[model samples]
Target: MAGILILYATIEGHTARVAERIAKGLRDKGYRVDLHRADPAGASLDLAGYEGVIVGASVHYGRHPGHLRALLRKHRAALAARRSAFFSVSLSARHKPAAAQRYVRKFLRRAGWQPQQAQTFAGALPYSKYPAWKRLLMLAFVGLAGGDTDMSRDYEYTDWDGVDRFADAFARPLDAI
Candidate 1:
């Protein structure tokens, strides 16, 4: 069976959870899915083994994880030659459409990825999961964006249905490839 590789980089785990859902959705359709977090500093894994590749990452301070960027650059040629998809996760995606779009564009350009399908999904603010400093910083940023700032709980802004649809979009292309 052909394998589908999902590599993600997440902070506070929201993107990780999304990756899991996407993997499950793909697996449900009988694709052999291999889910793993992108290693920033390590030996570059050969992407030749996977028939299709999906790369996901969350934004922090207006940038993606540095190591993932390097990896993407290293494999950009091979990835562009195959069926590939990219997803960016961010809290700004929920409230700041312009910022989210700009970030997505920036990431795509920086990563040298020209995926047939790309998605910018809203991420979450897990106050309970954050440390004191992060909670305050995120709450302030979110509050400015007109979002709930209560630090006692978490807030999720991702649209799972949209995520499912994106995964489905890649499914057929993956199978065809």
Candidate 2:
């Protein structure tokens, strides 16, 4: 089986959910899947033998985890050699249709790595999960973007079906290869 590596950097678990769904979808399709977070202290999962890789990250203030960026920089060559995909989760993805896909350009430039497939998934506003500073920061940011500002509960906008389809698409190219 072609092992698939799914790496993510999450703040309030939306990106984690996306990673889980993608991993499960790939596994159900008969591929071995590895799930990991791009934290420096996390295990250095062996990506050498994987048949493919999918890197996911959620944006806060238009940036991803520096830890993930480091991994991408270190594994640039290896990732480029494999069947690879990149998915970025952000509130901006929930913007108007014309503005929704706006993050790819900045993300690509910041990550300095590109995959065969790239996707943008809507993220969440986990006000309840945030501390006071985070909550206020998000509120201000959300306000500027015409997003919900209530800090009572969390809000998620990820499209699950879209995630599954993306996984299938990634699997499609691997199957072809």
- Sequence-dependent TM-score of model 1: 0.95
lDDT of 2 by residue, 1-177 (tens): 788999888878889999999999999989989898877564454678798999999876666667777668777878878998899888888874344455665666666777899888988888988889988988888898898877787899989999999999999877754
lDDT of 1: 0.86
lDDT of 1 by residue, 1-177 (tens): 568899999877888999999999999999999988887565466787888899899999988887887788879998987788999899878888788888878888887878888889999888898888988898888888889888887889899999999999989866665
Q: List residue ranges in candidate 2 displaced over 4 A.
A: 41-45, 96-102
TM agreement with the true structure for every prediction: 0.95, 0.89
Span of 10 residues, lowest total lDDT, candidate 1: 39-48
How large is the C-alpha RMSD of every model relative to the true structure?
1.3, 2.2
lDDT of 2 at 119: 89
**In model 1, what is the error at residue 114, expressed in angstroms?**
0.8
Worst 10 residues of 2 by lDDT: 96-105
